[model samples]
Target chain A: GAGVSQSPSNKVTEKGKDVELRCDPISGHTALYWYRQSLGQGLEFLIYFQGNSAPDKSGLPSDRFSAERTGGSVSTLTIQRTQQEDSAVYLCASSLWMGGPEAFFGQGTRLTVV
Target chain B: SQQGEEDPQALSIQEGENATMNCSYKTSINNLQWYRQNSGRGLVHLILIRSNEREKHSGRLRVTLDTSKKSSSLLITASRAADTASYFCATDALQGAQKLVFGQGTRLTINP
Candidate 1:
């Protein structure tokens, strides 16, 4: 796809189970970001990955939340021991590079933890 | 905390009317961007205004930036029913890696 691609458009999981969301950025894009949006609320920055540089994880809500980017391409966001509060649409975006051209977004993955 | 905060949680107007939305930020930003989301799907970039430039125009969309006040406004002139969507303002800080801090957003409903 020409734009960012996210896997499992919708996911339903048990409260104590773990869930993994995937993101594939546009070809040649070096900057990728992850954000979470709860119903009727603003987007919450979760993590960022820039080509080979250390990802900024300042926005991850808890120790259970983690993410990784391999080969500077595909990325995955993992939530361990998910809680009901973890339900939200997880969005992924990628830009040509960091802080420059506008980023392109994926449709996002809506996760529901029951 | 989110850096950008948009005013008027929601707005509704008829077709051909103009719509305006405001956003305020706390810190110095290198740039500000507007994005539109339809049906809560992926966001589409609208326009971007840099700190150096006070205003920019893209078709019917006009954007203004005030650095001293640390705020920006997005205006959609001659709107249509197709314009109904949620608009968000995001700020790229002067110092950070290209991470964008987004506001809660304004839900705009344009009646046909």
Candidate 2:
């Protein structure tokens, strides 16, 4: 089975610009999550979606950061007015459900804000 | 915010040696999981231990959970060079939100 996939393995953008990263989860996966990993830091939760219900946006750092999952399949994470501090690897993962199941991850989009 | 903290940010050992990593969390959890990530790659789930279970094993990997202490340990016996990667522990708090809080991770280097 194909695993999770993300687009734009590397992205370089100027400060204040907006960037959108895409993630394609595995087929039949009902749970999707986004996280950010900074250098020498741990994984920071961003947002999560389960099925077509409203997403759990509690982890989103600010209003500028938003994510949407369409048709319960693909998801897009948008960072508006990106800042240099937002530079990090954006990771996407999908699991069968939110419980204690294994999560499959994508290669991630490494965004660099210059 | 990160929920777990892994001890010993980095470790180095020869192949065939046993490697042990520990993780401690602040809150009660329904289950704990361990993952491995290669350089520049996404994380791969290694094992999961529920709160009721004390210890579990898979191949050469061993995971132990201590709910009383809110801590867990992962032991890799006879580690190979390929096991040289980053290890992370994630916790699913008892709240049942389904979101996992990950640790800072441990970088293990195995010399062949």
* Interface CA RMSD, all predictions: 1.0, 1.3
lDDT of 2 by residue, B1-112 (tens): 3389998799999999999999999888888999998874689999999999999999999999999998999999999999999999998778757688899999999999
lDDT computed for candidate 2: 0.91
What pairs collide in candidate 1?
Answer: none
Measured against the true two-chain complex, the DockQ scores of the candidates, in the order shown, are 0.78, 0.72
What lDDT is obtained when candidate 1 is compared to the true structure?
A: 0.92
**Model 2: how far is A43 from its true place, Å?**
0.6
Each candidate structure's count of clashing pairs: 0, 0
| Alpha-carbon shift of residue A82 in model 2 (angstroms) | 1.2
Model 1 chain B: lowest-lDDT 10 consecutive positions: B92-101
Name the TM-score of candidate 2.
0.96
Error of 1 at B32 (Å): 0.6
Give model 1's DockQ, 2 decimals.
Answer: 0.78
